[model samples]
Target chain A: MFPEELKYSKEHEWVKLEGNVATIGISSYAQEELGDVVFVELPKAGQEYKANDEIGVVESVKTVSTLYCPVSGKVTAINDELSTQSALINQDPYGKGWIAKVEMSNPAEVESLLSAKDYQSQLAG
Target chain B: MLKKTALYKNHIDLKAKMVPFAGWEMPVFYPAGIIAEHKAVRSSCGVFDVGHMGLINIKPQTSNIKKAEEFLNKIGTNDVSKLIDFSCQYSVLCNEQGGVVDDVLIYKLIDHYIVVVNASNTDKVLAWLSSHAQDIEIEHLLDMSILAVQGPRSLDVIEELFGEEFGFNVLKRNNFLQVGNILVSRTGYTGEDGFELFIPLEEIEIIWDKVVEMKVQPCGLGARDTLRMEAAYPLYGHEYDEKTTPLDAGYSWAVKFGKGEFIGSKALSKEKEAGPKKRLVGVVLSEKNVPREGFKLFNGGAEPIGEITSGTFSPTLEKPIGLAYINNSCHEKNISVEVRGRRVAGEIVTLPFYKHS
Candidate 1:
């Protein structure tokens, strides 16, 4: 399941854009598949990244998954609370688990991301 | 194709995450997750389908118990003659060079003895036993299934289920009792007090359901690994490989050097005097990094001293813990491990990060 207002990436990241700043977090589907989230490595504020850049990491008991930058931007903030309570991603993936906020460098890259419907279709196929 | 245990369909019905482990399609965990299942074993009780474990029976061909005891002593690292009837002891099977073949539990039954071995090493162990067969009759009990009921409350739960006829209260650690056809032993891999039931294949489901009805957590291999590691119990493949000896894996107590002419006794006796080259040690990461197998260990330096054999985020400790084979010379109170190219500080705690009275 995915939210209609958000955009999705093939890597299971969800982006909610508000003007030039877009908040990014892993979708609920991704968190569910990872079992229990134990730790997360977040990109720092002011770090520059290109679209599809390897930016962060999420760890569960049995696996480690990389978090990819959905679109080109400079990171502005990260959810600091995740360092202590990493299970927030499993508990509330759309809200308090938001990984980072980025100031989009190229607005045109937004067109490449799939809508919620397209993402759901991609998962099905 | 992977091997399926007797409880494979039951695991599938529970929607367990089935993974290929030791050539068997076994459940890694259920929906409750590994941490919760691990906690259940620590605080209350949990059940595990250990049907994949190998069971072998050894009895003297001429009905001589002394000959059977002698045969077992020649094949096992521990002195099997020490076992009283209906008692069990942890032992290891070793190669000619004193390297570990597998760690096993030997149960002395009334008329014969049973050796429980790792699932992955069962075939090899059987072949080894056959090669060393003298006057003993070897019976392979692979068709049977084993269920492990573990944790602090396990005895009470088992007593409640089996009722007074089973006499769960009278059973001591490493002792066993036969109720109906099932042989229930007060033995477990997890550090908790528990029982491992040796049952017929047809009876596995009924017993599993009965235990589940008692509200004990149904754990899988994922929690099983974490629980054993937290207790500093060495896994066969991880801590005791074909290249490692029991003395090297922090199990010197399991090896009786003076047990008299065993397969690896001569070589082990020699090594026992000199000590092993590498020693297994427990490492608790100072950072949040989960130490993994094959990761290099350092003592606050760039050069590597050892490698991790088994590691995980301990559910009981709430931190990353690991077992490693560091150079015996470099072992100290404080050390560091290279995790993802960064040297995370770690402390050398004693084996078994947790224990309960």
Candidate 2:
């Protein structure tokens, strides 16, 4: 059940808006598809990216995936705790497992992403 | 099209993540995952439903032990001619150019020897043996369903189920235990102290149900891979194949030359006399990324030399490791592996990376 408070990317990443900076984390459906997240390679702070750009990589025991950004922004912060504690993503993806924090270039871009209800229907389909 | 084993329903019920391996539907991981499964097998006991592999029961005619022996004498240099009834020997069947046909465990069962081959190469092995042993009878070549109960504590659990029915104590390494229709062997690929119980096809489900209640955990092919890698055991397709020669792969120890004329014996002897050029070694990663198959291996100077035969996140080690064939006289122990185009350092160590106590 995706929370209605969060925003979703077509790539299945979710963003929780908190002022000019938004917290980014892969959605539950993305984690389910990716299986266990063993190692999380976070993007560097201050790194800029375009919408849907591959900024980071996450690896499970048997699989590896690139993290796609939902919006164009400067990477202000990353979850350093994931370097040693990767299971955080599997346990509380939206909370402690939040991958990175990006300073938004335009808040209007949020409207372009899918809402929680829409993402659920997308998954169901 | 892929093939499914009899225990397919059982795997799904256990919430296993199914994957295709060598054209057979197999469970790569289950509810416990590979890490937990590997630890279970190391500390206690694990049950693996390997019913997909092929088992051929061959009844050889009298006065033809030599003929039967000559057929497999091609792979190993150590003499395998003295094998008697109810004994088993691990040997590789190779081609004339020293390429491997299949690495098999031959169990001599009284009048016949049961050949257990890799599931993918069952038909291929049969075709090769049929063309070569045309003079002999190929009767009762059955694909009997089998399961392996392997671990240090496996004996304790199995003794409770089957009892001392076959006088199993007398069975040494490479020996088979036969009591009535049941055939059990003191052999396993997991490098743990265990046994491979060859149950009749119709009776597999019943025996499986009985044992699941015990201490044995249903270890799928996932744990099997990690456990084998921890023990530094090689997979047939990854380590040795039709194009790979015996000498270069460092499995030439399994090829016998002193035995009289046999297929691929001459080439193996030549390779032996010339000395092996390449050897297989264990490479453990210093970092997080798991070393995978086909990753380029480089020497200390960061020069490309060899490639990893197989690699995975070692459940027991809690890190990444792999097996690769490198030049024997390479001079340096440190080598670099190109994992996803990034240079990750690795150290080459001896074989059997992990040994269970």
Fraction of true inter-chain Cα contacts (below 8 Å) kept per model?
0.32, 0.16
Highest-lDDT candidate: 1
All candidates: TM-score: 0.94, 0.90
Q: How many backbone clashes does candidate 1 have?
A: 0
| Model 1 interface DockQ | 0.58
Write candidate 1's Cα lDDT for B141-256 as tens digits: 96688999999999888888788676787899999998888898999989999999999999899889889889999999999999999998989888988889888987888888
Q: How does the DockQ of candidate 2 come out?
A: 0.41
Q: What docking tier does model 1 reach?
A: medium
DockQ for each numbered candidate: 0.58, 0.41
CAPRI-style grade of the A/B interface in model 2 = acceptable
Error of 1 at B23 (Å): 1.6
Question: Which residue pairs collide in model 1, if any?
Answer: none
Write down the worst ten-residue block by lDDT for model 1 chain B.
Answer: B160-169
Task: Give candidate 2 misplaced runs (Cα > 4 Å).
Answer: A1-22, A27-36, A106-125, B61-66, B74-80, B139-143, B300-303
TM-score of chain B, candidate 2? 0.93
Deviation (Å) of A60 in candidate 1: 1.8
